[model samples]
Target: MRHSIAIVSLVLFVLSMALLLTLAKQAYIPRKEVRDLAKIYLNTTYNPWNKKFTAMSPEGVTAIVWDYRGLDTVFETAVFYLAIIGSIALARGIGKYSKPTSDEKKLGLSLIVKTVTRITTVSIIAVAVSIALHGHLTPGGGFQGGATAAVAPLLILIAFSQYFLLERGVSKDLMLVIRSLGLAGIGLTAIAAYFIGVAMNKYAFVLQNQAKPLSEVSIPAYIDGQLISGTLWFFNISEFFAVMAGFTIVLILLVIPERAFKSSGGEEK
Candidate 1:
């Protein structure tokens, strides 16, 4: 009887969740209506005579995430970094072992790998830079771009092992460094916000607008609802670096083997 009751309870819980999700999915109004409402709610007229910015609304979403909500993002990044550093420290350490190593299979392999590495490295760098620079104007920004930048190193690592790069190694310490820098940057941004005597959302907008001069610069509704400030670009950049470093660390830990070389088949002993 108890088991049956528990099963019924579980079913009820699942059904409730399903109902909520369905409601949420169907909650949004039609796009045309939404746009019309936005126009009505957001449309503002310049009233210099009354010294009033009448009907002015901010880019609320940008403000919330980058400014007011930035603290959350900062702590989140901090936690992310802490986790990454911990993993690096735990997984990679001072150890020694030997195994057969080789890149001796084909003459063209070295050339191909080298070419691919160079092309990929350069291309990724360019893309990252572009994304970072135009983060405000377009969809992607620094965080996305920076993460993309991190890929270049991973590619290089794949093409050439630590031995080739003057004994460069990816270990726990390196992860700590990358994570530390990222977290530190985020912390500093937060601290700066406090000193500015404004909430995170407000600050994000101030900085973002300062960095990029957009004709239609207004805080989104979400941001207007809070104190976060900075252009969405800044937040985007932060996310980019955060994600980039994260994936890079994961790639190193997972893909870069202890022994990066081995013998090919059919070798005469």
Candidate 2:
């Protein structure tokens, strides 16, 4: 009976998908002209005439993310924070793990692996920072850069051990603080315009940049003749730190032993 039910369900699902595809094809309408909104964004994205509204980023995607749809990005960052918080909650007892002995701390890969990791880690972090900082000019942004930076810590964790990091003062608590500071920076950047407007009796909105009128808080697009995407740079930098710290915390928690929970008299769900 179970097998018969499974077969029937599979057949129904397939039939539904087929019907949906056929209906979609039947209802399809071809368009020769570009969408009005798409054309407008394309035309104005990099145009000097639209400097007030245009993010100087040559990359349209970065402009849209950091300028046109900033609130969406802010919410996305918040969602990432919530996910990290959930992970921390789920692994509440892991932090109670006793410190490993000096010998146990050395129980990692050989000298060759450690040497290679040390050599590459700095380069990886540098590239990630470059990606993040150049996000407005290029394709990548804070989230991407932060994820890239995270590879360094992960490499260290694998090449060495958690105890090695702990001895060096890289703890979950420190990461949490870093993450919090990053998030705070993001918030401050987002509302800086609003606060400035209030202080100066001008009109402003949250996340307003050079794109909007009465936006007294302006980040310079060129600092000493060097191109910088202003608020976009700030956002990317904050996001890089937040994401890097959050991921590091999560990785550390994952590597913690299950025995730690039991030893600490903490219940497992």
Number of the top-ranking candidate, with lDDT as the measure:
2
Tens-place lDDT digits, model 1, residues 107-204 = 22377787788788888988997786555444455566867887786776667553343245655356547655655565555454334435433433
lDDT of 2 at 116: 93
Instruction: Estimate TM-scores for all models.
Output: 0.54, 0.81
lDDT (C-alpha) at residue 217 in model 2: 58
Task: Provide C-alpha RMSD values for all models, in order.
Answer: 11.1, 4.6
Q: Give the runs in model 2 whose Cα sits over 4 Å from its true position.
A: 1-34, 99-106, 213-218, 266-269
Residue-pair clashes, model 2: 0
- The residue pairs that clash in candidate 2, if any, are none
lDDT of 2 by residue, 8-125 (tens): 9999999998899788886456679888997877776666687666666677787788778889988988898999999989877443567665676367899999999998998999
**Scored by CA lDDT, what does every candidate get?**
0.53, 0.83
Give stretches of model 1 more than 4 Å off: 1-30, 35-64, 89-94, 97-110, 162-175, 196-242, 258-269
